[model samples]
Target: MTIHTETIVDNGVNTEALIGARGAFTEMPEAAAFTFRSTCDWVSGTESSNAINGYFGLGQEHEREETFTIASDHPAVFAARDTAPTPPEIVLSALASCLTGGVAAVAQHRGIQLRKVQAIVEGDIDVRGILGMDPDIRNGFNSVRVRFEIDADATEEDIRALVAQSQKRSAVFDLLTNPTNVHVDLA
Candidate 1:
């Protein structure tokens, strides 16, 4: 088995662990209100930031089943061909893309020419647990594992170093491995 690796620079900070380190601030946003708009069929509303809207039709037949697409300045595309992405699936995709992009960005910045980058992502989530039907189990994914395939002319050590740097800088990777408080207020 060929062990693919990447190199990384450690700045003594594991960004993943600092998920909620900022805590609360004395001053909040002055507006306390925001707005966003989109014309694409795949995206709309302020929640989407106007880049793309994830769409799914309504009614009982569409419950938990609908197609999703992306409408951006570049192209209108489908997120998942057969069905819409659930909340957890979105997180998985975010991590996968982050690592892939991070590797390419770091390699280019460091003058390393990479031929290709590919990633396979997997996560474990128990529906019963997440639905609160099982009190003894955890509600979120227990763990996530990613497999990356990279094509570069660098040596084993060089590859390892690059991968390490990508991991350290990957924002989504940090979010998953870290804990944060999500507050929801209903008016």
Candidate 2:
């Protein structure tokens, strides 16, 4: 006989535990607020590396399982070494990751099992703005698109609704769609 813990995992999410957490957060809404941070350092030739390991959540500090590092660099056309993915690519990745996680969580909560999830994310950018060739142009992607191919134990309408709900709850999606105040000064 196989033994199983009390955890009820569906689509890789602990549905039972999450339900309990939802109740806790509902009672103490302040605990639901979380702050995430990442530190980045410039390497050379438009190359930079970032590290993330700690965050504050549930009214307390928490550390990640391990330090995660990411590297970004510009292409050679911009006199860069093209060492790693570009920063914009990383943003797309973050969006995809957040959406995918939301999908899994939502599926688990709805008792839907996911078999496969694939996504293709793309962004359209014009370098003229960043290069200062046109002041009127924006220095970011003009548009971003994400297409998902998900195989789950649910109807097509349900899957579509799952993806839609994921987008509605995705932090990264909101960050990209809305404006955020950013301050950078000499430290």
Best by TM-score: 2
Give the clash total for candidate 2.
Answer: 0
lDDT (10s digit) by residue, model 2, range 78-154: 88899999999999999999999989999988878899998889999999998899999999999999999999888
* TM-scores vs. true structure, each candidate: 0.57, 0.91
Off by over 4 Å in 2: 1-9
Q: CA shift at 123, candidate 1, in angstroms?
A: 0.5
Model 1: per-residue Cα lDDT over 4-65, one tens digit each: 88855342334443333323121333232223223334333212212333333221122224
Candidate 1, TM-score vs. the true structure? 0.57
Reference-based lDDT, each prediction:
0.62, 0.92
Off by over 4 Å in 1: 1-82
